[model samples]
Target: MDRSRTALIWRYAGRGLLLTPLLFLLVFFFYPLGSILQFSLAPDGKLDFAAFQQIFSRPYYRETLWFTTWQAALSTLLTLGLAFPAAHVFAKYQFPGKSLLLALATIPFVLPTVVVATAFIALLGEDSALNGLLMKVFKLEEPPLHLERSLKIILLAHIFYNYAVALRIISSFWSNQSQRIQEAAQMLGASRWMVFYRITLPLLLPAVTAAAALVFMFCFTSFGVVRILGGLKYATLEVEIHYQSLSLFDLPTAGALSVIQLMTTLVMMIVYTNLQRQMTQPLNLQSSRQVARKPRRWAEKGWLALNLIVMSLLIFAPILALIERSFTLGDGGFTTRYYEQLQENPHRSIRAVAPVAAIQNSLEYAFFVTIFSVLLGTLAAYLLSQKTRFSRWLDPVFMLPLAASAVTLGFGFIITLDEPPLNLRSSYWIVPIAHTLVAMPLVVRSVLPSLRAIKPSIGEAAAVLGASRWQRWRRIELPLITRSIAVGATFAFTVSMGEFGASSFVARPNQPTIPIVIFRFLGQPGLANYGQALAMSVILMAVCAAGFVLIERLNRAVIGEF
Candidate 1:
């Protein structure tokens, strides 16, 4: 065929692939969001702001908003402080087990909120084994600890979940900086602290700001963490949304709160995105092989040691406690009954599925979500890298679902699909579709950078040599972008696996996910239930860890080969 016809065919094929994501987003995201707007505006076919008025008039709603803001701010500050030093260490040094340590640091961030809450409770609750051990060590007559059901506990969990965000974003920038600037600063009689404050810290400010904004937004909209650990006293906007929607059935109030929350999040994202754009600069280095020749003084060693210790305690201890509880017996012996009990059907409980079935459900949903999200995300990323106006506009629109809370989105889905024209409420597809909405942004973000890194000339060269479009993409683009696709798929898998908010709203009674099952077990007050929760948590962690490792291996095989 002539070049004109070949180009035409290629363009149409590309459009077809790209249209899939747009269609998916339109049906699941924009349609549901439109439904939410309609619900909030019209009650009985009349336009009203009663929902907004009710939310504003109530002191409880105001309190929830205020508490949520403060808690999220505090958590962001704490996470940044802890993550800065760790990021610096990782960026500057080539330590043993560096990859493994980085992986471990991220584990807590990806685990289900319910699992993290339960793990924390297992380690530090009033009746926990740690409290018992402390009591014995101190020779006290009673266990004296009250960590659970406190605002502090909630804040700590937020920090644990988000520190990786600060670390990764800041450190990625940090690794690209030229060490010679710091060396020159040192040679000019600048102290270590002075160099960091005046040079390193200033350089990292953009990424730091972006990371903080994201973390703050996450904590502000937190539901599962606050619900499980914050008790009734510490309700965020998210928890309030949940209460208004589910417990009180006050859709108007919930809808109003969700709109406000969505507005606030969008504002934050806009401001952060603008700031990030302003601060973007060319990297001094692109490779991670760059080394800092500065010797590790005693203080630096101590700092590393302290960070390692803190990470172990803060991230791994709770997970270890969960595993221990899963195996510990009431009579102080090891047992496997918790795992065994998972084989039993959960229908015996209150409107719950079998634990094994929940696992199956979660895995199946995760698998589909991963596949769909990666495909859409990859296409969007590829289009965006072409730097077309159409892709730029579409890019931010695609990310809107991420800014909205899952609770808000779930409510939107519920209100939108309650009727006949396009009913999706009772379908199994609802949860996976919601999950795809949630996971797509992550996939796009992961793949976009890698796509941009591939020079446009490579594809042009193939076309000039009379190579077919399919052969060019298959032999060139696909090989280059496969690792990114894998990374995006891994992220989607983990996000869907641990997802709860949307799942809770859409999950069928007979098809509960693992997180839902764990939440159920935690609600009941029995050894068997608690053990089962811990055991399920362990399995959830294992699933996430195994997925992560597989992705890492893929990265090594494909991306690392370059």
Candidate 2:
């Protein structure tokens, strides 16, 4: 009878804990999303398909759809091609400065999209040193390579920016894999290539598929890279949404486009999740005692060296260009003018505000996003860990924001809340709200794994020793999951600071964020503007680096290792 009573009490307590996250999702996520869908379906205050029909009827829109689809597909393929070998190398080999190289590879992923776009321009722009050098070497009167405003440039930028996603996912999975299977195949008279194809590739399929799906989705919704490099010719759903809403003031059409984009993203995510379930297997490499061996043949070492050198150049060249350009002067001498410009107010700029204001705005939004997302995500994770029916359904729902494009969601927010008791536009709250939507999913993913790692009996034990529910949570669960929460918060902070798509739509004109400011400067002409842009980019990089270091230190203190 006592055991039954205890079980019943615990069940109710778990249910109560679940309610908070449920309420949060219902209010912030589901309701806003539902409002947009409803508004898109009935833009004229009656049931109609006018918006969608208009979009499908137009040839331009159809062309955009095709362009976005193929470019994203090509980008994913290229990224996979580059990332797979790099991931394999990192997983199988140990070398000097491996950690630094890995961190450098990840830098592109966290950088602001505008910074990346500008870096590409600085590297290959009309008056760039690369263009000048090519002209000089070839004795040509004109710039020989005109990659600007081309589909190929857009695709390359996407691959460069998102390849890290594939590398990280594949490398993590590969590191936790045992070499015994491959060794056994080799001993059975299998060639090295055959062994990899027959054994290693099959086991790595899950991570590969997951990474591809994610990369595809990211490329599909790409806006800044497409807009900056592809020019007006290449319009993805993201770019179309922005142009339709802001430039053309076609809210209904934008809403319709957003819905279509959301559906496409959702389908991809569902396919990936289902595939992941089927691909699951016991990963015992973590406990396996055998150490990895280095390649013995000279040819193998030469091949490995060539691969590493090529990957390093591909990943590092653009970054090196940016850093070098940041210091270069017109007279071919090094200068600190760009770095100094960051400290001065440049009010004559289009935005008419000090650069520091943008930095502060980004930092503030990131802080709020980190705090709220971590708190709410931790609660949701705890509820999910308890294994309730409602919790199971809720788990996927929290991930909807991640599956939806930021541009689409921002458009949804614009149309749905143009007026009403929940009107949010034309307010300071828009940017942070949009950021929260994006960061929440990262928070949940990070927290859920840690929450699941803790055994339930620990909480029960504390409760049995006359501890109150709050005391049990404070002393046990919180301590166990604190590192995960910090990691989630760090991710949220970095994402919020660097995010551009939603910020462009929602940020107030006077209160533009760092990325918005960088874009503004890059669009203008002149050495001063270019210098300022580079300075701002450096500042943004410093902020991200500092935040990551703090996260690393906190993780070590709380969880002992990442």
Distance (Å) between predicted and true CA of 307, model 1? 2.4
Please report, in order, the local distance difference test score of every candidate based on alpha carbons. Answer: 0.82, 0.79
Candidate 2: clashing pairs of residues: none
**Candidate 1 global lDDT:** 0.82
For model 1, how does the per-residue alpha-carbon lDDT over 73-151 read when each residue is reduced to its tens digit? 9999999999988887888777678778887787777778888888887877765788878888999887788888887
* Candidate topping TM-score: 1
Top-lDDT structure, candidate number: 1
Record all residue pairs in model 1 with backbone atoms less than 3 Å apart, i.e. clashing.
346-354
Overlapping backbone residue pairs in candidate 1 total 1
Q: In candidate 2, what residue range of length 10 has the lowest lDDT sum?
A: 284-293
Could you tell me the TM-score of candidate 1? 0.91
Q: What is the per-residue lDDT of model 2 for residues 1-562, given as tens digits with 9 covering 90 to 100?
A: 9978997898798778667767766766677677667767887688889888877898988888888898889999999999998888778766667667777677788777777777777677775668878888999999877888887677778877998889988887787788788778888899999988888898888899988998998899898888777777778999998998899998778878888888889988997788666545676565212333465788767866877887777777767667777888355579998777766775566667877788888888888888877777777777777677877887788888888887877776776656777777888877887888888777778778777777878878888888877788788878877778888888889889988898888888999999888888877888888778877877787677676777656655453222
Overall local distance difference test of candidate 2: 0.79
